[model samples]
Target: MKKLFTLTILFFSLVAAAQTEDATSSEINENATFQRWAIDVGAGVHKPTRPFVDGYVSTPDLWQADLGVRYMFTRSFGVGLEFGYNNIQSDADASVTFESDYYRVGLEGIVNLGDFVNLKSASSRFGILGHGGIGVGFLTSNARTLTDATDHHLNFTAGIAPQYRVTKNIAVFTDLTIIGTTRNHYGWDGAVLGTEVRGFEGLMINASVGLTFYLGEGTDPADFAQDPIEAKVDAIAAQMEKMAIENADDDQDGVPNYLDRDNTTESGVRVDSKGRAIDMNKNGIPDDMESSLNARYASQSDVQTAINSANAANQNQIKQLINEGYVNVYFRFNSTKPTTYSLGAINTIVQYMKDHPSATATLTGFADEIGSPEYNKSLSERRAKMVSDVLAAAGIDASRLTQNGDGEDASVDKNSTDARQLVRRVTFKVN
Candidate 1:
């Protein structure tokens, strides 16, 4: 009884300490095993505690067999009922060769400690259980030829079962137990032996191995198992985010400081988008549309004519801007620095302000959809300040430049890179 109490305590301690987060798919399925209804059959040996029932008789050939069915309410706890046959044999030297056939039916409370704890090991397949029960044991002995000799006694049982799961539906387990009961006609004096004999009337060690078959459809294994594909995808996304933070650049032809280096070997060579040297006239922007109208065009009168025609068109756009009272300048994503493409628009505003000294321009900055509102608001404010600083540097009065930031308040096309670029910009209204 003390051993049983000690074993029970140890089992609960193991369960409480084994909890962790790394349970594998197979471990998950193994846990699912407990929700099943099972049938088991076993046969093994039992060693009696009493040295002599009626007299000094050397007991031998001790054996036991069992058949049972169990239902698990949860992975941790269950209940079972079983019928058992046991025989206690005596040595040939003993008078009358004492033998007792004990048959009993019992109800048990079972606890599966392993699954209750949920260990983290991926390869763990071992399961441990602790159980106890009570029932009636009918004792029939060779000496029980008389009606008085045949008696029934209360049986108390406690056991530990260690099992290895081979599959979802089947497992092999060994049950080692201590069963206790009493024999009615005890000594040569014909008196029943009392509790002073080994803890609970009498005791025996019963050990058996059996095949357990899960009878019904259990819980699906996939329900709690982690999805490998989804895990991989999440890992890849995290890696890409880290790379973005670290600024991964295979070719150094991108942006801001380190990413701004040209891919070409030549130190001073200006390269186009493909990293080839920029052609003076054959660059993507046609010579006629260029703001400075390249000096190379100065050698050709036809090119000069084309440049003059473009300048006239620029003048007409300027007139339209003046009529409308302002112009808009766009920036790249998350940048406060103005681009050469937008500086022309800024210069036009500068020129218009110079022409009418009473005019004041309000610069409102905006940001793309990629960042948080608070961060975008701060970024937008910086953008507006950058434009205002430029206007001050360009000889415009500080008093005439008023700046504002709208953050991500306005909607713009965000379906593509080029579209989102349009949102990161500053607009102007002259009054």
Candidate 2:
């Protein structure tokens, strides 16, 4: 009994020292959670590790088989306790071989390092995994030979198992283990007439086999998720690319698209015809827009040397936009009526006002003057007032809005009706 108790304690320590597997799926799924518990049963040959004590009588047989069960706390990790019966043999002096069986309870720690490695997670239908653990047990003999005596002792073991996942709940695994023992139970005893006992005593050796089974409730169907670290990194990279597209300065200059003073430089001293930075106009503004009419380049950096300047954009800039309050509104054809989609934009504006109560907005409205200036002027004023009402409804203080009307007088395109219509729209310039 003392031997059994010591063996159990040794097993516990072995299991305690084994490493635990980390959670694989990002989210917790109830079914998958249950798979955390599993049971394993195995059978294999055993070799004792000791000296000067023989379980085998003279001329007895030499090998024994062992059997046991293990319980897993995690699909990827588990610990097992088991017992086995053994047989020891001797050489021919007509000396009889002693036979006996030992009862054992050992704690085993295990890990599943998936497909490419050792173990599998229930989340993946097919994955590879690896597992390892240590165990200890008790031994005793029930034989009549004077030298065939049994005593209390402990067994130490280490093993490596590599398995394949057939399903989230089931898997087939194989393992090789090196087992060790604390006492000698195979060498010469007082009954031995020869100089040496042919049988071995305490020793360390290896064995291998394959097993298949269900993990348990913890390894449920829903425990897995689409959240792989590789996928997350890929998504981040894609977002960065999109930002590069948005911040590319249309007019090639040292400054980026977000900082450009003139977004579309058709006729501006700050930009060129292609909407690039240049001082050809002689004015401080870019030459491309001014077309040699005025502005001059302030510095060489201000010059737009390349037309198709493709520079990588910064992620922080895009992230900053998200962090800061922002609103994007898309309008319909020549209609001043606010659509449902505009509510999203209005909500953002509302948030902005809540965050910065002192912020101001200028609501300016324009109209294509196909009609008389008198009529268009009134139309523009009405449109501006309409927008003002929306902002007020959304919680903006009415007093913060400075309203203006540009009656068909200014058009983005003097030649096209559509372009003229586009110019005749409402704009809120926040300050």
Candidate 3:
């Protein structure tokens, strides 16, 4: 009863800690509030501290195995109790025969150090933990010499042990304890040191192992969550976030140090508003479905060709988004205007926006080297404004635009020559 009470107190301490969310992941997600249980079976050896209990009256400390169960009230907290038996042995000379046995039951609190904050997914996830708890045990044994002339007694153990959890379902631990047993007596075998000897009584120390299993039914976290479908969804969301950051400007050319030939390009795809394609009519199936379809129709192609091209583009675009993002649209050097060659790119991006209409677009501008801090600032702003203009013209809802400019402020590299050129681009984002 004392063991149970002490364990309960420790258990409550961990319970308080669990009230907080997976703090970091709390904003990410959470699993359902549920209860779980686990069972473990293992073996261990027990050794007593004192060599003499009452002359030769001692018990053999033999190995034993037992089973235990754990109950998790939350993903981060739980409690467990286990019971087992140990055979106490005496010296081989039979100075004392301790054929009897003693059983122990202990209560320990379990702390889940970590767990999947994503509760929406189904999977056998893991968590780390450390626990400390107090336990009480009862020990009884008999010493037989030439007869079953035995004596037995019960005792209590009080101690606090610290454990490191290996995972949500398993743990390797050690217990530090001081076992308090009732005093007993035994007759001396003979004179040991000119005077008769009896038994020695005191507290004993014992170490043990522990393991736990999560009884929750489902797929593993890796296999279930963060899969292809979830990845796509998250990609879309990330893509939207990117657009919101980019659409703050629409010029598509809201970038400096470079020029792209297209206007009213996709939200996150940075195209130059000034640099028209020398190929003038240069065209390719936009890496996006909407783009491909629009490009096909612009060429006055067959409707069937447009559909096929769009389908192909959509597949490829999705692949890229999953691997990179909806549109890994980065600007080239010396470019501040959308090049005509970017029509296809614009088409691809616009289609994504159309598909996810609720998303907002954001635009951020950057400048490459070659301009003073103040000059780069204005240049970047011009670039971003150009992008905003084109996006607004592209039929995107004006209200969804989140245009902004950082100028040369957010340069990627200040020392490198090409840094300014690369930084001269405007980024488009949707969120």
TM-score, per-candidate, Cα-based = 0.44, 0.37, 0.38
Q: lDDT for every model?
A: 0.61, 0.47, 0.48
| Each candidate's clash count | 0, 61, 80
Poorest 10 consecutive residues of model 1 by lDDT? 220-229
Residue-wise C-alpha lDDT for candidate 1, range 199-263, written one tens digit per residue: 45556678999877777664422111223444467689999887685564333434323344434
Q: After superposition, how far is residue 194 of candidate 3 from its true place, in Å?
A: 22
lDDT of 1: 0.61
Q: Write model 2 residue lDDT over 151-223, tens digit each, in one string.
A: 4444555556554556666555555555555544333232322343232234434343444455445325211
Best by TM-score: 1
Which residue ranges in model 3 land beyond 4 Å of their true spot? 1-35, 50-52, 55-61, 111-202, 217-431
